[model samples]
Target chain A: MQSSYFTGVTTSNGVMQHDFTVGEVTGALWSSKRAECAPLVLMGHGGGNHKKSPAMLGRAQRLVVDGGFHVACIDAPGHGDRPRTAHDEQEIAALREALETGEPVGPIVVRYNAHLAERAVPEWRAALDFLQGVEWVGDEDPVGYFGLNMGTAIGVPLTAVEPRIKAAVFGLHWPEALAEYARQITVPIEYTLQWDDEHIPRESGLALFDAFASEEKTLHANSGGHKELPRFESDSAVRFFVRQLVRPSIPQPDLVW
Target chain B: MQSSYFTGVTTSNGVMQHDFTVGEVTGALWSSKRAECAPLVLMGHGGGNHKKSPAMLGRAQRLVVDGGFHVACIDAPGHGDRPRTAHDEQEIAALREALETGEPVGPIVVRYNAHLAERAVPEWRAALDFLQGVEWVGDEDPVGYFGLNMGTAIGVPLTAVEPRIKAAVFGLHWPEALAEYARQITVPIEYTLQWDDEHIPRESGLALFDAFASEEKTLHANSGGHKELPRFESDSAVRFFVRQLVRPSIPQPDLVW
Candidate 1:
């Protein structure tokens, strides 16, 4: 996995955000020059969202400025800068028509998820391979992951296959294809669960967490919708990664916002 | 809400399983002779399942044999002995076809859920009214609720308007229609969440938990599919109702299994 670095994007803080593409996977890396050889985190975005979405950026900004960690994030297949394949377009069009016509979306969603996971799991691994050797990172950088919704879908399976990631903050939901594979994942994980998600069932979320073969997993559930998780929970997630990857000696903020 | 009892069915454990029709809802009642005028529990089954389904029956059996509670479960609208309406048939057929053809099932599920919720919630309320004054129950009996998937969708709204219900054990997922009404619910709630459900997303399930206005709600999440929740969780739910409704004055079993 080769990468191209463009440091044109500047942030309000001293941290520098750079754009990089490894083949079809496009992602951004945020890091502070002062924080060399810092622990690195891979940010996975939700479905229908890009790597630089407001929510994703908010998290990246905090990790870089407050948590003092280098962060890398990428767009999944057919999302953001990655070109949507013809098959992807067809599926999207069909789903839209069904929704307009008042057809059931469950079956469509299941199939689309399967299709996406087949590609996404591998794509994330490739991005991780590319993110590892950047100048801000080291040959033995302590790696972590944080993502929700579609991000968890990819992260769950990616973590199962790629042992390089030391820890992960995954929450909410995952792909059906990952059912068997989840039992094989023993990564120290911090999984978030929203109490009442309208789209994802509570049982489904718990099932994913239970499937994780990880002996060191903590369930951080809060009251909210799919996107309505509390800031304190994310702060808790930040603290989790710190404790797991970089050691909790770093004084963290009360909130990541 | 009027009721007629037919006591033709009796169980081996001295728990009599009787048939009853309460307005539009038809359900079976399970009662043990040892618990007279005991606390009553209302059982709501998931979609595509009826009152006497193995899962629902197991819950009722536990509440009766161990928890010293009389259990009442009614079929939701368009389920079980209640014949499906023409509209219900059409929607089910379409969903079946979609599943067969690999078409999107989400659109069909949304419509069916909308159709079911419109009638099922009121049906449950009527059943609650009928169950209150039965021969085995007093006019002022304490009532609890247990249901999943479609059950939560109906149980949530039913628990919202019908404050007579003392406590509830609900989980799985809910329909989008319950978003506004959930905030009105103040009853003590015991909700379950499955981690890796294929049909419902985890965030959506958490959103339902967040929507509830209950200040005394506990989220009981487990690892499994929508249908694969561990029995231990259900045992915990039974214990929850016992503590909330009956106060566990009776001896509770070690493992509800």
Candidate 2:
């Protein structure tokens, strides 16, 4: 197996960030400056986003500062620091044209993200292997996955196959190809969707949430467009991780709003 | 309008309790022992429950101690200290029979709660009128409603007509009688329902949530039965009120787990 190693490290706002890579895949790890061995949360960025996107950084900060958990996010195949293949270019142009022409983007996003997941899931497992091997991210604590949109695309399959992921937060994608994977996932889940999502139909979003076989799944459907997923949801996701990853054993930290 | 006055006062666990009456109606108010002028939250109890039920007290404590908000709950007509009418007696017996025979209780609960709402709405308004008259609970700040099951039935209608209620957290009831009222409500809302509820159909729960015209509504559907709503949801509701009521002016408080 290819090894993972840190490329650089930076600290800001009380969070220590380490830029790292698992073979060719670029990733970032976030933890409190006052770090300790804690549970790990693997976050997946959305379509057209990278490991250090503002959304990813903000959520990582919350997980680190509030949850006291080590957080990591890898660039999806053809996203962020990764180079795109000819096939990836073709899908990107097709998605762009669909958006420009007022065409339904669900089919294209679903198909393209599904294809990416096949490659991305294995990379995530490899990344997890290296992450768990690290001294700060010891394998003793259960791992968690937090991702939405294209993140959900890759995460559904990864969590389905990855027994190490005890809980997940996923939403904002079509269920056409992912329902099968979602069914295999029996861990606790928190799924979010937009009630009036312009890109994804309401029924389709609900269908994906319904497909989760996790006995303790929760669906948070907010009334808004696809991009209007409230900022507060990020806070809620932090709480979900705190509840799922830390509990009866550790004294839970107060959630700083 | 019937005037309301406090009949008794007590303090426990840093929460000051006030027993008050509005005409024949009985209700309880909860606040921090170190009281101040702050936002008000009107919480409603579930079916066969009263103002100071365990659930109500638990939630009220969170609002008062955590959110620094005054909280009040009134006994529904024919509940707690109120006398039951002959009609209330008949409905109670019918509901009991349905439960014993493994018959569908949704229809009976829907019909009974709606009838109760007709009387309960006025009493709630009267209680609010008196609550706002108190110096500590001034009318300047927006009011919030929190309730589930029978509480949702009464709260939906009460929120529809009460212009002071700017936000609400309601759920766990059918749409048959409340849909019309829900359609008229335009405030922000947080609704909850059970995904695998034995008593309420999943679609019916979704449908009731659908009828709400609030542009900023959220549906929190968890995987559980009618009575198995997770306790953390109460904490979520408190945060909802803090965000809706506190805002860019008052810095949000830390959420203690």
Candidate 3:
């Protein structure tokens, strides 16, 4: 195992910004005592949270420890040291106003939010580009993605536009638009739902699943509620991603504590 | 196709508290629907939500409409029209306190909340008894469960304690204690996770998945964040549950829109 490295770097996305890279690669060997890179998995956190979110970090750790995948996580726009755009507060106020007026917020508002939430994808792509340009990491290393809530909301759409992502695992959020996006994705994908998740009704989950065009799809249900992370099937996620991204010829090492 | 029926009754501690019966039953013809008897699926909702939560309702709809299974759903304590109990408030306070303290909270808290949430499961059981007493429902119908966030927390532990539930689908939440509980579960199960769920971190998901004892398990990652629901996958969940609960000899009808 190689020692993990953490560095803060500035990247341009039509604007200059700082983001953190949390792993290291050495001469065709990707290693981070904390993570491994067969297919580097980039993670995005939800709205109002950062890459340090307990949930996000938990997933990051899982991808690193169990899946043997290196993770590149970043805070999205209006999140984690990033400045909010002029429309950010305005959009939030509009949502609040819509809620107060009891006016049915239309899909346009949702679309707008989704668009804003994904503003960082360009930056993420740049970061991935920089990673790919690294001398130590292999040039053809596959890339995977994992995003939560708003992260999923933005990431799913990004997946349609960015084809480098080889596989993905999306958690909690599953919207109708995902159907359109799922049709565009060629990578193996996994989607999970929280049965009693009051925040985003289960119908949304059903709709997203119905949208996926992949035959490699799988689903797991645990006996827990929406607020908790799914315990019964998380490791399977690691296994699935590793199996798809890592070279199959390499024997999986027996996991030891 | 059989006509669907809806009725409300009360129960206590796995027994009926009332004798209200509104459907007809023959040797194998059960209740208001003419569909063949299949396993009974019990569904529960989360706090401030009812059995009709879009997610919960959609799941039940899938079970009934697509899976060709019978579903019984009820609002838990302090939820829906059910009266709140002191224990409910206490549990909520405890959860908040735990979160505030940064202490590790697991499925046990969710299970404890479930006990408090549906202090009236007994009443629901009574209703189940009434349904079972009907000629068509059959006394030996297999039983399964599906619950969302809070509903899952409650249902998982209840299913663990009650030997009747043969299988289950737990959405959103994955608790740490699940590894130990997985050992106790003798039925087929599935769990869902949002890779980028903002509400719950992925680490918690890993802790929960590590607990599962089921050998026959699968995980799916859809492209969405936490707040959104996975409506597209509802059919996949229904398909899984149907395979687990419904016998192949019974001709299942196509899903109705």
Mark the 10 consecutive residues where model 1 chain B has the least summed lDDT: B248-257
TM-score of chain A of each: 0.87, 0.96, 0.74
Worst 10 residues of 3 chain B by lDDT: B23-32
**What TM-score, to 2 decimals, does candidate 2 have?**
0.96
- Which candidate, 2 or 3, would have the higher lDDT against the true structure? 2
Residue-wise C-alpha lDDT for candidate 2, range A36-132, written one tens digit per residue: 9898999999999999888888889889988999999999999999999999999999999999999999999999999999999999999998888
Sorted by TM-score, highest first, which candidate order results? 2, 1, 3
Rank all candidate structures by their lDDT, best first, as comma-separated numbers: 2, 1, 3
Q: Is the docking of candidate 1 incorrect, acceptable, medium or high quality?
A: incorrect
Report the C-alpha displacement of residue A32, candidate 2, in angstroms: 1.2
User: Evaluated with TM-score, which candidate comes out highest?
Assistant: 2
TM-score of chain B of each: 0.88, 0.95, 0.71
The value of fnat for model 3 is: 0.11
* Backbone clash tally (model 3): 82
Q: Report the error of model 1 at residue B192, Å.
A: 2.1
What does candidate 1's lDDT look like per residue over A19-61, in tens digits?
8887767889899857588888998887778888887877887
TM-score of each: 0.52, 0.96, 0.45
The DockQ scores of all candidates, in the order shown, are 0.02, 0.42, 0.06
